[model samples]
Target: MAPRNDTAEPVAAPAGAAGLAAAAASHVTVTLAPLTEQLATYLAPADVQRVREAYKFSDAAHLGQFRTSGEPYITHPIAVTEICAGWKLDTDALMAALLHDVMEDQGVPKQELAERFGGEVAELVDGLSKLDRLDFATKTQQQAESFRKMLLAMARDVRVILIKLADRLHNMRTLDAVAPEKRRRVARETLDIYSPIAHRLGLNVLYREFQDRCFEAMYPNRYRTLQKAVLSARGNRREVVGRITEAVRAALPAAGIDADVYGREKTLFGIYTKMVEQKKSFSEVLDIYGFRVVVHSQPECYLTLGTLHQLYRPVPGKFKDYIAIPKINGYQSLHTTLVGPYGTPVEFQVRTRDMHHVAESGVASHWLYKSSDVSLNDLQKRTHQWLQSLLDIQRQTGDSGEFLEHVKVDLFPDAVYVFTPRGQIISLPRGATPIDFAYFIHTDIGNQAVAAKVNNEFVPLRTELKSGDTVDIVTSPASRPNAQWLNFVRSGRARSEIRHYLRTVKYAESVAFGERLLRQELTVLGLELPESTDIAWNKLARATGANSREEILADIGLGKRLAAVVARRFSPGADVVATTAAAVDEFVAARSAPILIQGNEGQSVQLAPCCSPIPGDTLMAFIRLGQGLVVHTTDCPVARRMRAREPERWVNVGWDENPATHFNARVDVIARNERGVLGRIAAEVTAADSNITHVTMQDDAASSVTLHFTLQVDGREHLARVFRFLRRIPQVQRIVRIKG
Candidate 1:
């Protein structure tokens, strides 16, 4: 934090001291000299050469182009690479980091990098490239696309994120050079996209750094104000830290536990966000600093926690034992927020050496143990478990934006370290409800999820789960997950599963709808749907992304996807490949029932008095998507007349096979005012076993009554029987089915 010394500093402008200082101030240079020594001390000789080559190549490529702040652009790459180098990334990753932006900003082609550096390095660069033709029209769209890119790359290899983080870090550090609006934009993006990702990956240090940097740019005035206050308050804070640090160290050693104690300051963004949320000032925000006690082993971590609790009273409901229940992001620690000096809540985190390493370096250190300090063999073994979970969530997510959203919520969860009744730890995202925990156990359990028992007490599914509470996800095979649980699910896996379930249900419905329409059309065409027809339709649908023949019929019949356009074109019936027109037509013709109606009351079909369908209607039949059938008289124009134009698409749709939903059709009757007419009409309809939902009567030298009636029927024939029976009422003048 100290400025450069006399030797490095300019006594007099020794040739180009002003330019160098300006360059230093501009890209806001950090001392890369410190990182170079650190890397040489860590990397093997062979790997060192590759890392060196990347530095050389990138430095040369970015030679003349200065950063907006005026530092040679080479410095930006070096600084970013320096951060990645600290993460001990492989030589290929380090190389990619060095050249990450060359493809996007410079005219450097991806091919040249592939030939020169190898495909791995080139592919990494290409993955990091910005959308080539992005119009940047809306910030929201641009952000969405950027998030999509990062996620796709992160899915393949996490190293891309590490490089991207480092790049963003450097950019944020020098954000002052950008326009004020641009600064805010970058800050917002960092907060929204990158910070959460780092947290999800368990890169706690980087996550906090990203937030603080962004906070500084976004709220410089507040940052400066708080910083000055913090400087003045340092004396009091140091006294509290010293008192707690001494007490914890003394208690741990006495309890036969050897540990290293380190103090942690809450990040600026963390403090600010809490302040804004709680409507509190900096002084009122207690527990703003914490202490980490790194022990020698897992058992000692617990013993040390006990010893610390004995020294200071533990705060109620402020403890989390993550050592027993590791976070989804692979973070493990024992956390206890205690009432320390002056009754202020002071948080303490206890961890083993390895847990501390994973807590800091995350998966990176787990892959290769360069440090003489810590072993991450446990996290290394569970790497596949984490990766599999990520892959599972991704597989179920249907879209990129959705996938990214779930990952952010679930992966980098503000965790609830819950326990099974058996004390098995389950870390769920913060705000996860009990139902989310249900699906986490098994899909069938979730699908049949009904009620839950948290600690043997029946709790609502929306109950927010807490850390350390033993939860038993009580499920019955008969119990079912509610569509409403989607509002509370916090896990990516759970959320994705819920969405998938809903989508599946919707698709099934769409298929059923399509099926009903198809059956009606075939009936209208005097074609019987063959036994083989359903299967063939489904197969054709699968090929064309349709679910069934009905969906195809519905699509074609409704003119949504165009039925005739996809009619196998009906030209020569020749599809030499799969699904020829001849095969389909033969299938359709052979199944022909050639629907014939035995006329009961009228020569032509009329709109039923109930569930009215009028002329010029664009209507379609609904098969519950998955359940029973209902036909909507499409737009207000009604259906019967439009049926004449394409009689083939209308099916011999009777009434419900088994009635589930009630249908009410409106009847508007006009007559010269007659008092007994309405009563007589109602009696006749009631005799037909039809019930009216409502009856409205009006007078204007004539009477009009609009009655919505409900009736049970097998098909149109049954409906015709009701109509003919009701027609016998003498008081009824003219009855017409209401359209729409």
Candidate 2:
């Protein structure tokens, strides 16, 4: 085998330079022996033996390789496994963690690991492996594809992500050896992506550590300043934190509550984010000290909260009962901010010991699983639910870049927990709408959602839901995902599903149109359109570099491959006829055939809002990527300008001559600024048999006002009638249609 280049571990100082120097001053040394001893404290004899074997194999495989820090490559895997061991993962997870880099760095095959250890460990190792073997067009694409594979692996087995997080955590910890630019890039990615994942998984320790490390790597100066500020603040607030901790400890005991109370300082990154978001100075951010009370039972957690509230007045709107309604990631706690000594706010987190472990370790809280706590099932179920959602998103989003984007949107842990009609808690992204909630309930509900009732009052489908809101969705068989829903829906699954349905419907429609256009052109050449089995169509597809005849036809319809070009391919003997201008004109007329536009078109057809073209107006079409065909009036300056720049993209289109639905038209009416002038204009528009969709006015002077009315009318004739009525009004000075 060719010598494998192992680039998994960065060469930078794994530990911060300050920490390393401090350790050196203390005459401390670290090695795999200490890590092995730590593993021995948790793992059974057989599991320990397996880990030892994994280490030996990894060490041998990476014998010739070294990290940028000039350490044997073997140490990186050992450190990663040590992190996993801290989580007390299963033997398979630890073994996979030890061998995580082998497959990529040492070219060790999955089959080999499966044979040596077991399939589970090998699968975990495979999941951790990158798709470096395959070629990608750009580094971004390569990274996206790698993330996609890793995410798919995680969905299958949550352990994959847990192990991956450990691997990244270690890399981030020692990222000082990497080149400055690369280190910043990695740190930014860690901060943006991995830290959120850790939070979503409920790994609070790793999450905090990841953020701190990323802060240090990305903005070392800012991190040092913040670190110094936090340290100085800690000294200044030591008395305050002590008082609050003592108060909680004293109150809990007096209330007969058995709990472990400790002061929790905010992470440096946390403080930095607060400073940036809230625009506060370090001195102004006084609520940086908090207290955590770990109780023996769930009931005791509530008691602890009550005891603490007795000590300090609870801040209104700051108390959250997450114990009753855990976060989507299965984080359970009673969170409250209390007005402490000197009127400073002091936050408190109260949870059971098991809840604490899960809150910190998240899904990797193996102790909870081992203890047979029912909450473990809840954690697993929630993790699996989110993992399954990834599959659903993946199904709808075929493009790797789009899938990554949707996943990133989901990684943000900020969520609002709402309730369905039946009291089922439905957690959604903040700013999520009724449509997002309906989809989270079920895709069918989303597909058929027509109206929504929040707390028994009807609201728009795009109404942003809030926590504790009881939302009742009214669905209809005739209703489907509105294109407008895309504007308000916040969840990845909702966006992907909506886009997928629209794309599928558009593609199916375009296929039909392409087939018709091709057949019409073929008929013009006196040739019969061949069936799918016809060798001629298949040959034409191959000649056009298309996979199938349908693809060629669809491309023709989409204007990617011209119908005339395909027609020429199928009828090679008609070259002389193709050169004739009249024949080309006939083919063009047949193919164009005035793409009929109704008011209601899917994402494939957009009626240009600039001109507000009605059915009676001459229309032109421009094909936009992903937006399908956009219709505009022939005289629309915006459309004309676009056509001038790219004339080939414009296609002939016309209104259906009698559109069933009313079209929106804009008219400017200059009216005298009078008290009832606006009311009279609306009454006249209503009297003219037109509904005002929207009206905007600007005061041209003290007496004159220009009102822009977006009125719904049948066509140009109806609009003209409304304009005439508006012109007759005594308040109206002049009326004219507005065009782009």
Candidate 3:
């Protein structure tokens, strides 16, 4: 067997005076020799030949191009390919890495690449290529669209992102040669998008490198100052680090556990972030040391942890057993922070060799080792599951910008492990609500989720989930996603699913409402709507430039077109009659009688907050353009002004016999400013079978205050009952509903 080489092949000169002299003397230039030599160790002869052929093709394609550093553009592709090679990617990935930019920059067609290489390689290259041909209104939109395409492609094939990351890594390393503005832009992009992605994939080594490089580029002065501080701290702690390293090395063997132990320092960016986030001084942040212990087996990992704990006292609540419940990214280890000599904090990570490999390489470990170990297989499975979710988000989201937003939400690294009622563990992002947890289990469950219980205690759906909590979702057939869910959901899947359901429901409601309006106008004209197969329907669709009858109706319902105009088009030559006052009254009654205000009307019908209109309140509706209906109380000031300004837009509306959902109503109270006054008022409101959704306080004087409360009530009767209950309180001097 040949010796193993894990380090990446260097494509450029090292940074230093000695390396510069060597480069100047030899006129060092990038060549395929070193990469080919490295490939021979793992790849077949035929595969190596294919990579060489790809290199030649890419070199010719980029013949006259040069990078900002004045190096042949081919060097960039070779460097990316070499980086992929370090991951032990297959031949197709290697070829794709070499030709990734050809389609975007060289105008090489996809078909040509498909003919030259295999279809897989061509597809991989296409996935890495940006969507530059289309025009966008803003630079941010264009970037988002391009990123959306690349990520969707990556969801299908993981190698696309792997190669893209390698490409980005090389560009970042040489970013200093680019313009300062461009350097900052690229650095920001890397920090915001690529670094999180790397961390999400469990490529810790690459993730750390990206953060450090971006930090240096974004804040050069801060980076230099922090570098000096870290170095100074390192020198001061050398003796302590050496002492701990020796203790671990000696103790592990004595405990009959064979392990490789080494002291590790936190990355520069990581240290800086901790200082900023924790608001600690450099010395305080640097006092904590890190170490890694790689054992030969999983059992030995725990044994090694025990040996280390015996040497130092373990800190309370600082231990995490990832080995038992692995991270969503498939990172498995036993991490414990301990108090070392001189009361300094020491953090240790214990894992087996395979676990260590998976932790560092992430999904790439499957190809790097070519082993069927459970750890590697689990890593691949977890990565595939996450990628599949990306596809799900893409399918539900319509806009590229929205898709990118969803993906960015999922790229967060912090996760909390929770459980279902059945005891199945589900990992979600920190601050995730029960809505996110429900969505994580299944989309259908999420759409129908009405309530949830955490640890057998009923909690709000928007309650932030904590690790180890057993969550049981309560679903109902009639329950659907509320638009308010978008405010609290932390997962991409949950947000996308909620938006998709609302959009679908809104469209259907619009179509139905539009049809009703059209029917009423046709009644005024002594005509009836044609059947689906009627020739008149097709004619009306064509004349109105509508794709279908439903589309025309939707336009009318959305207030984009007038029902009267559409009805007139249906019978253009009919004698027109001037509508009489009695006729108008009858028409108004007919239109308003059937349009009942149901609280669960989705986005098509919104109750105007200006009036807090509920059931039993005489209501009027205004169909604003593209926003189906806005219902309001008859006496609302805003509704009155809108009716005066746009009389034609107003529609008569009535409430259903029973509203299915709670409506928000504001109550103002002048009360004594005594202790527990607010609590008593809240208790009274709740006792009246109403929920207080919001509250605000205003000081009227030192001993008197005005309190405002927003309560969720079923209807006018419920509001009356709440008032009666509040009137019973002696501290409440005055109470009245606030109507706008």
TM-score of each: 0.67, 0.80, 0.82
lDDT of 3 by residue, 355-381 (tens): 888899888887887755544767777
The order by descending lDDT is 3, 2, 1
lDDT of 1 by residue, 553-616 (tens): 4443232442223433222343312332324333334333322222121112223442443222
The CA-based lDDT of model 2 is what? 0.79
- Per-candidate RMSD, Å: 12.7, 6.3, 7.1
Tell me how far the alpha carbon of residue 267 in candidate 1 is from the true structure, in angstroms, after superposition.
2.9
TM-score of 3: 0.82
Better of 1 and 3 by lDDT: 3
Note the residue pairs that clash in candidate 2. Answer: 11-68, 11-69, 12-176, 12-177, 13-177, 14-174
Best by TM-score: 3
Q: Candidate 3 regions off by >4 Å? A: 1-28, 372-374, 524-526, 532-548, 562-600, 608-617, 633-650, 655-740
Instruction: Give the range where candidate 3 is weakest over 10 consecutive residues by summed lDDT.
Output: 1-10
Best first by TM-score, ranked: 3, 2, 1
Per-residue error at 537 for model 3, in Å?
Answer: 5.7
